[model samples]
Target: MAFHKNLTRVERARLAVTKLICPITRDALRVIPLTDFIFGIYISSRYRYVYIDNPKTGCTSLKSAMAELELRGRKSDLDPLNLEVIHYDSSPLKSFVPIFPKPTLSNLIKNNYRFVTFVRNPYQRLLSCYLNKFDNSTAKDNPQARRMPRGAAPGSFSEFIDAIIGQTDHDMDPHWRSQSINIHYSRVPYAYIGRFENYATDYVTTFHKLGIPADEIPTLRHLNKTGAGRASLHEFYDKKSQDAVYARYQDDFVNFGYPYELPD
Candidate 1:
């Protein structure tokens, strides 16, 4: 309901980060890849838009749309999926390279060319991660799993939450890491931060904020969706487990305006 506000989303986000996140988190977040282009960081040099890709929240789907846009004037050599993959074909569209001398990255953020990212409710995102990644037997086969404390996938959702809370000494898995830590809006500040729950309106609002025409914005592909769509998070959590989750991801809930109180 609040698109095109007098104070922009970027302005509000920068304020929220400074006020809500402690100095320690702000420092930790700043020490990340300058652009993080290798992961979900999608940038369009032509349009001057940056989308910080958060895993489990429409990463591949949005990437597909961006991939299509990348081919606008360039050669249409790669197919949709290949375009999303980080390769030579996609290089021309990238806003910045992941390197020390990142003038392109600095210019974009400093010049304010519409940085954006999507977020989901912390509880739903956790359930999606469990049902999609940690709950599986084959997750240990993932490259990052080799570095996990257990050297294998968490056997259950409860165990996964424990892993997140307990694995302070090791790198936290990005799929389940705190959104506040990942986006670090205080440090970089997004022009628009859309919610996955309100994907329809917020998705449109993103382009609107960027001054992109509605006709040019393509529909997002629903990629890598996990488990039954109807399954409620309430089913997976007991009061105790739910409380554990709240303790673990309290900042996410508080920052995103999500309810953490356990259902009656």
Candidate 2:
């Protein structure tokens, strides 16, 4: 809601009127439905740092880190020199969604705004996703769990990896950097770049560089959402699945400096 800070008083007033013309409510604008097509302009104008959620990339923990840095409020009185994190509950690559068109991540970068993001190794990430789908907490009632989606329970972890890696239904973009290019070696000035493996150190360094105090950082839960539920990386992915994940993500691996060796 505070992301509307870049708007003029008159512009904000006009946006309010425009909202009334559509399905309008306070919480709707705040959190309920996460979409850049609906609220991108407001968010981009207010926050300089944008967290592009590519799903299952330790997003909850990253959001907590941003909140700890006091970037959640509707308005920030802090100096413009500080980082303003813009979080998207959904993927910003609107082309995948029929109702929404493409967003302007390229334009924002061209404007010289500082950007940062985190990435997880794809093989481990896939394993974690399978475990989450079958994790008991997801369905408290045994009967309800029976109604879960197909491929939710592939029986074995290897089967789950085979299913996910074998299928080509989902988006292939890497979650770490905003774009698929050379994420770690970008010549542009980035405030900070983080790895999911070393989140605490990377997070603290980013905030410190931004002049935020150590006390301002909050404790986190679910910090290892990237790979916490996996029983064994070796057992989960076979050589084929490992090679597929690596082949598909080679660009991201080389660009972000992630280890690209196929799992043995």
Predicted model with the maximum lDDT: 1
Writing each residue's lDDT as its tens digit, candidate 2 over 1-264 gives 222436667656655654454332232343222232233222223334544444456655655555544444535443222223323323221112111122233445555545565566666655555565554235644431332234244576555444444333222112211224323224334566676667668766755654556876556555534344346677666677777767765666776677866333
Query: What clash pairs does model 1 have?
Result: none
Q: What does candidate 1's lDDT look like per residue over 57-129, in tens digits?
A: 7666666766676666676576656634533334444544322233333456766767888888777787887
How many clashes show up in model 1?
0
All candidates: TM-score: 0.77, 0.55
Supply candidate 2's per-residue lDDT for 214.
Answer: 80
Residue 200 in candidate 2, Cα distance off native in Å: 1.5
- Poorest stretch of ten by lDDT in candidate 1: 97-106
After superposing candidate 2 on the true structure, give the runs of residues whose Cα lies further than 4 Å from its correct spot.
1-47, 71-107, 110-112, 135-137, 140-153, 166-190, 209-211, 223-230, 260-264
Candidate 2: residue 238 lDDT (0-100): 67
* Model 1 Cα shift for residue 107 (angstroms): 3.2
Candidate 1: global Cα-lDDT? Answer: 0.63
lDDT of 2: 0.46
